[model samples]
Target: MLLGIFIAASSAGWAIAQGAALRVPDVPYEPTPHNVVAQMLRLAQVREGDVVYDLGCGDGRIVIAAVRERGTRGVCVDIDPQRIRESRANAAAAAVAERIRFLEQDLFTTEIREATVVMLFLWPEVNLKLRPKLWRELRPGTRVVSYVHDMGDWKPQRTMTVQGRYGPRPLYLWTIGSAPDR
Candidate 1:
């Protein structure tokens, strides 16, 4: 029974991703757990000097938190215009509007070369879709943090289950050039 439950839970994210794969839209706007948000920032080792990018940013919570907690500057990119507007408002509410750029742009087309740390709460397929982009665009040593999905075939440098809003959830971290890009 335990194994069955485990298998079901593990496959659910992928099933959802496949359902949404045709569009590859932003991972459903379920906000990352607040605890997980800080954990993601910490895992990425965010610093004031780091230029971060939160792809598929929803409500801009992650970027706002990064600026508020890490004193870092970042850009929030979400394909949804509504999310972009909400992010801007959230940034203002958090008093970090000037430190962040809100772009209502497709994640795939956005330029992420300037980022030293990138955060995501996207799906497995989206991560796979973005993996090559991350390798081709991000500079060596750039850190990438994904809340749940693992970039398929590119094993993460680190993976751990951390406390979240409901329970423990896996957070994956990979540093660009940690190994020669295959």
Candidate 2:
């Protein structure tokens, strides 16, 4: 009976044991350049009273910077435990750990309804797959920003090119419920 239960849970994409991820991450860990992070914050117009959520947060730089620079609270969600640990350490080093919460779990399953701004640095397909969840969970007027990828068929309200480690990378911004039909 226990083995059957385990099989059922695993088939549904649940982690088989503690410390394991519910599923493999959609992309590898790649830190966004500091310049791009700054631009993301600027483009998002992050400010006090805002609750920022960095989906698939790597090293927690985005959330850390948001909390430190804008006095906003943040949530860092990553499937990788290592990334979560790194994010926590980085947040502590930046002295903004109290303002940031780290969740070591799948970004797909993380609750983001409280966020006023959502940051994404994931792959194109991942962004596409995550679009509906963002649209459904986030409140109206919430800002969604993506680096290096754009959500398909959902036009961004604003787009800008920012210099990244590899050269110019595109940043996209969309306000939930403000755009026309997808």
Candidate 3:
């Protein structure tokens, strides 16, 4: 009976493993340039005194821009220690170090409960994994802005296509209300 139970447990564990969702590997990090930053800011509608959070914040460009240009406070999160160091340097260089906090953490584990605006540049799978977290934490009117990717099964409140130095860039904006009709 014990041997049979062990076999059944092993089979069940294997089945659960097969049913688990897998996160795609991290994408190559790229900074949003100044022109793209402008469009994101426009779409996010960030105002002074608002707190912004940037998940997978690569090089701290978005956080730096938010604090420096919009007079808002920001939290910048990145899993890579090297990227965190780079973001610190970038924030200091931009003279917004006092207003932005750089955190070295996995994006899936970081908390943005106090944020009034959230920025994202992650892949679709990462976004999907984070959707429920955002819905649970963000206040009803808080804004979410994404670059290059959209949350599957959620419709954006606003969409903009801006012509940047590299080419046209797509920006998506959503609020933390009901999930958009799939």
Give the TM-score of each candidate: 0.83, 0.87, 0.81
1 or 3: which has the higher TM-score? 1
Question: What lDDT score is found at residue 75 in candidate 3?
Answer: 97
Q: Between 1 and 2, whose lDDT is larger? A: 2
Misplaced by over 4 Å in model 1 are 1-26
Model 1: C-alpha RMSD to truth?
10.4
Please give, for residues 1-182, the per-residue lDDT of candidate 3 as tens digits.
Answer: 99999998997787567642133227567877778887788888898988989898889888888899899999998876667788999898888898988887877788788999999988888889898889887887899999978898788988888775578877899988754333
lDDT of 2 by residue, 1-182 (tens): 99999889786654445555656789999999998999999999999999999999989999999999999999999998878989999999999999998998888889999999999999999999999999888888999999999999999999999998888889999999844356
Strongest candidate by lDDT: 2
The collision pairs in model 1 are none
What value does the lDDT take at residue 168 in candidate 1? 80
* Deviation (Å) of 47 in candidate 3: 0.7
If ranked by lDDT, best first, what sequence of candidates would result?
2, 1, 3
For model 1, what is the error of residue 21's alpha carbon versus the real structure, in angstroms, after optimal superposition? 17
lDDT of 1: 0.86
lDDT of 2 at 20: 57
